[model samples]
Target: MFVSQPQYEFPFPPDLEQPGSQHWRMVELTLHAPWFLLTVEIFDAEMLDCSMSRTICIAWDYDLAEVLRGLDPETVLGIVCMMPAWASPNGQWSSKEVREVWMCSSPAGQSVLLVDPAGEEFDCGLVPEHVEPLKKDLVLRVAPAKPRRRPHSRRKTPPTGNRRSRRASARKSEA
Candidate 1:
């Protein structure tokens, strides 16, 4: 049996100076060939407080099949929330607080589950539009079976002779 490791791609914006201010709003996952693209929309709470909602789109890539197969009901598959850290009076950013709310596959593989840092679990109900295709693909596609090796068969070996000499002898006989 062959199993592939999941590859992830998370591209943060170049201008993101304050990593602690961003908070995730919504997450969308779509399958693009061998890659599962997770799109997360985040807004800065500080910007929202100033009457401006600045939303940014961040993406992550993963192998969803591998992820699902390896997931334990108690294990977190991925994180969705980003905690904020305020700057100190010296204009230096304080140590960022890491509060993560994670998503995982259910034990039955029929639905997704969410777990917060506090150990509270939530049921993810009603498949979203972005994930509908992925769910359908998983349902419709059959699991891959291990490749089988064919039985060995005996065969006659080729004559032991140099190719050039054999060809010359054959040419003389023909002439």
Candidate 2:
């Protein structure tokens, strides 16, 4: 059956550098504390002339602290996907867009929620072996907790016992 696809617009309008010569290309997807920060590198391509072209690379870092608050870190996985989209020549939309896919995995990393480029959610039949490695590869940058200083002891040993012990030793030495 032949079916037409529905169009989807990006949440934000693409930045227009020139009047009608702006297009963005997805260069890289970086997950910094995937659970907290998601960064995507995009290159803006603009035609300078008939034979020359210029591209400016920019990094868009999204802070998910507010969005991902209270989520369990161990089971949460941030999937960054580059989606192909139709963009206008005026740079109102980029050719490619980066979207963050939030998913949960089982303790054994067997269960996973997968979201495709079309925003369709589905279950991946089996967990990829690399999922564990990918999770391990994540470098978490967090400040170490400050060491707690213990309070000083207030009880003091009685001097009378020490004096008696010293006297007994001296008497034994004299004898």
Candidate 3:
């Protein structure tokens, strides 16, 4: 007796067949890149002024690296972030801590721990050009937020010399 197996089919809807959908998937991938690199400089206690601790930081992001290279020296140099919101834990895209990017030939090869400006460490993965599309998305996604202007304070006129003060002045003159 011969037994036949039932055939199952997945409906490939028209949406899945479109090129735009494929591009969308590509863009979505950039949001979650798997490769990064961490280039850490030697730690200096005098420069850090905090409790005496020796720690070096590293960072890596393909898009982030390109962005850092393009940023003005004034933007990255000597900029101290008070409260850094990490992208790994906090999922915040706007981070001043990503100082530079280091590209590698593999996505999951040599790995190192990266310490953010906030002093939090995480393993950074470096990848080659396998995910260029995602880098574009990263650039667009991590654009700096526009500076918010503080509300101006209106100048308050001192209560036109109060009546009591005026009267006192007049009496002083008469005396």
Off by over 4 Å in 1: 1-78, 81-109, 127-175
Q: What does the lDDT read for residue 28 in candidate 2?
A: 35
- Model 1 poorest ten-residue lDDT run: 165-174
Candidate 1 clashing pairs? Answer: none
List, residue by residue over 38-91, the lDDT tens digit for candidate 3.
222233557753222212122234333454445442223221122223434566
Compared with the true structure, all predictions reach lDDT values of: 0.28, 0.29, 0.30
Scored by lDDT, model 1 comes in at: 0.28
- Best prediction by lDDT: 3
| All-Cα superposition RMSD per candidate | 26.4, 27.0, 24.4
Please name the candidate that would achieve the greatest TM-score relative to the true structure. Answer: 3
* Selected candidate, larger TM-score, 1 vs 2: 1
TM-score, candidate number 1: 0.19
Q: What is the lDDT of residue 18 in candidate 2?
A: 46
